[model samples]
Target: MRTILQRVQHASVTVEGEISGKINHGILALVGFEPEDTNEDFEWITKKIIQLRIFNDENHVMNLDIQQTEGEILVVSQFTLHAATKKGNRPSYIKASKPDLANEQYEKFLQILENNFKAVQKGIFGADMKVELLNDGPVTIFIDSKNKE
Candidate 1:
């Protein structure tokens, strides 16, 4: 499992000119998965994302998590996160799970988030989505369950 988290003042996703999901003062998570990604990975990544101290505190230090700030989360399926670019000019998605599998994973991931957190929004699993976000601090963090970095 892999995810790119962007701290945003607000974010929204549109599909076919219709707003699907939106959030305020939280994180925009672009998520992907591999064929081998397991429930364990989902559980681990969920904990990491929610517990991350990326938001600022009263002293202006990045010491608060999303829950502490009472923020929401906007999650989008992003198979491209696993694009392998070592070969040719075109990127290969060989590392990404097939749509059937990834869609299942995506749903499971969303369920986990909804169960564990508050105010969660999401984009369609396999739709063409346009995402708009005002990046707060332009803070972006990439997390990979396999690498654990």
Candidate 2:
């Protein structure tokens, strides 16, 4: 599993001109699953995301986790995160999980977030989505479950 986590003042996802998921003062997570991802990957990545201390505190230090700040989370499935671009200009998604399996894992990931945190939101899997956000601090972090980095 791979995720691009961004701290946002507000974020929203639209599908066919209708808002599907939205959040305020939270993290916008673009998640992707690889063929090798497992339940362990799901557990570790979700836990890390919720516990990440990217939000600032009273002293202007990045010391607050989402749970501490009562922030929201908007998760979106993005298989393109696993795109392979080494060989050519056009990317290849062979490393990404197949749609059936990816959808299942994506839902399970959302469920985990919902259970562990408050104000969890998500975009529809496999949908054509338009996402908008005001990036707080312009802070963005990339995480990969397999690498543990």
Compare the candidates by lDDT and give the number of the best one. Answer: 1
Give one clash count per candidate, in the order shown: 0, 0
* lDDT per residue as tens, model 1, 45-102: 9998899999999998999999999999999999999999998899999999999999
CA deviation > 4 Å runs, candidate 1: none
Lowest summed lDDT across 10 adjacent residues in model 1 is found at 110-119
How do the residues 50-79 of candidate 2 rate in per-residue lDDT, one tens digit apiece? 999999999999999999999999999999
TM-score of each predicted structure versus truth: 0.98, 0.98
Q: Which numbered prediction scores highest in TM-score against the true structure?
A: 1
Model 2: worst 10 consecutive residues (lDDT sum)? 109-118
The lDDT for every candidate, in the order shown, is 0.96, 0.93
Give the clashing pairs for model 1. Answer: none
Model 2 vs truth, CA RMSD: 0.7
